[model samples]
Target: MNSLVLFLLTVVAFGSCLKLPSSFKKCDRKTTDFNQCLSEAIYGALRILDKPLPSHGLPSLYGVEFPDVFTMGNSTYGLLQKFYQTRYIGLSKPENINAKLDFGPLTITLTIEATYSQLTVETEFEAQGTIVLLPVNVITPVVYTLVNPTYTFTFVLEEYEKGTTYFRVIDSKIDAQTQGLKFDYKGLFSNKVLNEEFNNAMDEKWRQIWILFKSFDEVLFAPLFGTIFNDFLKKVPAAELVDG
Candidate 1:
C-alpha cells in the first residue's frame, strides 16, 4: 500500500510540472528572440540616419540662403522645411548605435552617438539616446503612418520575419489648403486645370505623396526590418520552434 501511495505521489508531481502548453513554451522563447532582433534592426537602420544624405539627384534649388519660405509650383512647401530643420534634421553624424533587450519584462531600448559639421550648412541627424518599446503584440498586425504634406506614408507588418513579409506606404494631401500658391505642372508635381485649381493641386499633391510613400514601402524598410527579425529568430531554441 505504501509503495502504491509513493508511486501515485511521484506521478502527480511529474504531471504538475508538465502543466504548461507546448505552444506557450515555444512562444515565450520566440518572443525573446523577436525582441532582440527588433532592437538590432532599429539600431542599424537608425545609424543610416546619421550618415550624410547621399546626393540622390535631389537638386540643390540654390538660393541666397535656405528660403525663409517657398512654393513648389502650386503646392506650398515651407512647413516641412521648418519641421525638418527643427525636429528631424540633425546637427552632427552618429558615432555608434546601441540597443538593449529585456526578455523578463519585454522591452527594447536603443541609443545612438552623433556629431555635427559646422561648415557645409548640412546636418546629420542621429538616433541620439534610446527609443523604448511600449507593449507590443507580435502575432497581430500593426500599421504606422508617417505623414507629411509631400507624402502620406503607411507601414504595415503582419509578423516580424526575416525575408517573407510585406511593408507598404501611400502618399496623400490635405484638402484646399495649399499654403497659398498657383501653377500648372503635371506628373512629378501635378498642376492640373481642375475647377478649383488650388484645391485640386492640394489634393493631387497629397495623392502623389501617398503614391510615393507606397512605392518606398518595399524598397526602404523591408530588407532592413526583415534582417533584424531573422537574426532574432535564429537565437530561438530548436525546442521552442517546434512547440511554437
Candidate 2:
C-alpha cells in the first residue's frame, strides 16, 4: 500500500515464479566454474518462469489472489468485485546474478526489475490500482510496479543429510528503486477532488513506510527460497557438483 509495502511485495510476489534447478556436478572443487555455474543455475531457474504455470485449470505466473477484501500483516486492500481472471505477470530473470561462498555461508545477489508487470484489481466501474499503501478495507483496484529490485542474501547450511539439506537465511539486504507509481480509486467515499487529494497525500508520505516493508517483508520473502533451495541442494550439493 505504501512505498515499503510496495517495495517489499514487489520483491516477494514475483520470486514465486522460479523453478528449482535440475543438476550440478561435484562440490569439492572451489573454482571459478563453481561460482559461474551457481550463478547460471539461478538465472536459468528464474528464466523458466517466463512461461506461465498452471493453477488448477488457470494459468498463473507468480500469481496471487486476495479475497474481495483481506488483511495481510498490517496491510489491507481489495475490490468490490472478485473474479477468476486475475493473475500475476512479468517475472523475469534478474539482469545480473552472483553466487559464491562467504567462508561458511553461501551468498547470492540478484538484480531485478518489474518494469513489465501488471498488478491490479479490476471492477465494473473503475479498475483502480496502487503501488502505494491503501487504507484498510478500502474498495479499490490495486497495482504496484517495481522498476528495479535487488536482494542479497547469505545462507548457512545448518543441517545436511545424506538425502536432505537444510539451510537458513542468516543475513539479507534489499536495494529497491522505483521508476514511478500509480494509485487510482473510485468508490463510495469519492469526490473526484477528495480522491485526488488523498492519493497525493499518500504519495508524499510513502517514505515513512519503507522501514517496515524492509523489516517485515524481507523476513517473509527471503526464507521462501531457503526452504526450496535447501531441497535443491540436498539433491545437488556443492561438494558433489563443483568438480572436486
Candidate 3:
C-alpha cells in the first residue's frame, strides 16, 4: 500500500488555535497561482514530519502507527489476511509528485499523485488458508515492499457552516500502481525453501495479488483517512485555512 503514506497530505489542515509552523507554507485560495502554490506547500510539508507537531495534531512520519486490528479475506485468492500493530517508515520520501487542489461551487477536491521508491511497513500478521493453491499459516513479523509504486488519491470536500464555513471530507478515492510486490515473512511454512518459493511467486504475480485486495483500499483506507482528516478540519474553518 504505497499510497497509504500519502494520506498525510489530506490531513494537513490543523486547528485554528494552533499556529502554523514557520516552515509550513500557506497557499491562499484567492491567489492567482494558488493551485501550484498548494502543491508546493504540500510537497514541502512532507519534510516537516521528521518530528511530531503535537500542538497541531500531526504525528511523525518516521513511524506512523496503525494500531487497530483489521482483517480482509478474498475468495479469489483463497487467503484471509489479518493485520494488527502495524507501523510504517519512510513516508517523507515521496518522489515525482504532483498535487492539485480544485475548488468547485459546492466542493473542494484534492488529488495527489506521488511515487514511493521505498516504503516499509512492519506488521504482525496472520494468514489462514492458501493463496493460489499454496498452503500457508503464519503469525509473524511481515515486512512488505511495493517496488516503485505510484499512488493517486482524490478527496472531495463539502462546506458546512458553524458560525463560519468549514470543509469536511464527504468522499474519497484511492488508486495505486506498482512494478512488483515483495513480502518477507519471518516464518512461513517453517521451511526456508518454502518461504523463498512463496516470495518468488509473489514477485512474479504481484499485480494479480494486488488487484485481489484492491477492494480493501476502498472498504478500509478511504474511509479511515476521511475520518482522520475530517477530525482535523472540524477545528479549522475553511476561511482560516484558505482565503476565499
Candidate 4:
C-alpha cells in the first residue's frame, strides 16, 4: 500500500516537467466537457508512462523500487509484522481509468479510479503473532496477486501558495474492490499443508479481512498521501493544472 502511494507521488512530482509529446491531449477546465476530456487525457498518459522520462527526472513506473521498511506494532490486530524490500508491477496499465475534478466555491474535489487486470506485489515479511489464536512465527517471501482490482482515490483540496498557486488535500478517501485474490506464503506454519490451507482460506476471505482493517490502513495512509501530494503540487502552478 505504501509503495503504491509512493508511485503516485513519483509520477505527479516529475510529471509537471514533462514536455509531453504532441499526441498527448490537454484538457481546458473552462470547457463544458472538461471532465470527459480530462479522463481521456489521463487514459492516454497512463499508456505512455511505463518508460522513464529521464529528461523530466521521472523514473520508469515499471521498475520503481521501494526500499523502506514498515513495522506494524503489536495490537489486537493479530499480526506483529514488519515488511521491506517490496516491489510492485502493473501500475501503469490501469484499464477504464477516469478522473473527475470539481472546483467548488470552497474546495477542489478530485477523484481518480481505475482497474488493473493483475497487480503483483512481492515482499519479504517477518511476523511473530497469533491469528485466530494460532501461533504465527514466519519470516519468508509473500506474494499477493490481485486480480481485476479497482481502486478509487478522492481528495478535497484547499488552495495555498508557496511562491506559486498550489493545493493541499484537506480531506481524502481511498477504496478498492477486487474480483479475486491469490496469496503465496512460505514457511507459514512450519508445515506445507497448513500453509497451503491458510493461503486458500485467506484468498477466499480477502475482502472481509480488508474491510476489517480498512480504517487502520486509512489512518496510516491518508496523511502520508496528503503530504506527498502537497509537495507535488508545489512544483506546478495550480493555474497550469486548471484555470477556473
Instruction: Give TM-scores for every candidate, taking all chains together and pairing residue i with residue i.
Output: 0.23, 0.51, 0.80, 0.73
Misplaced by over 4 Å in model 1 are 1-204, 242-244
User: Candidate 2 overall Cα lDDT vs. reference?
Assistant: 0.43
* Model 2 TM-score on a 0 to 1 scale: 0.51
Model 2: lowest-lDDT 10 consecutive positions: 52-61
lDDT of 3 at 223: 71
Task: Evaluate all candidate structures by whole-model CA lDDT and list the values in order.
Answer: 0.29, 0.43, 0.73, 0.72
Where does the lowest 10-residue lDDT sum fall in candidate 4?
55-64
lDDT by residue (tens digit), candidate 4, 1-244: 9998878876765555433456557778888989988888867766776886544334555544566677876836687888777776776788787789988998999888878898777779898889788878778998888789886778899887544456777887777777876888876778889889989999888887667435533564455445545555555556656656
**Candidate 4: residue pairs that collide:** none
Q: Give the per-residue lDDT of model 1 (tens digit) for 58-144.
A: 111111022222112211221111101211222222232233322223222222222222112221111212113222111111121
Candidate 3 Cα deviation (angstroms), residue 35: 1.8
Tens digit of per-residue lDDT, candidate 3, span 7-87: 543444332334456787787777788878877876777777777766656667667677678888853569888888877
Q: Pick the candidate with the highest lDDT.
A: 3
lDDT of 2 by residue, 1-244 (tens): 5988877775654443232234312232356576666666655555664554332112223443322322233223433332233333343446666666434344433322223333332322232333354433444544433335444555554444332232333444443444343444444245678777766765565556445435533554445445534444444433333343
Worst 10 contiguous positions by lDDT, candidate 1? 56-65
Cα lDDT for residue 222, candidate 1: 36
The pairs that clash in candidate 3 are none
For every model shown, the clashing-pair count is 14, 18, 0, 0
Candidate 1 lDDT score relative to the true structure: 0.29
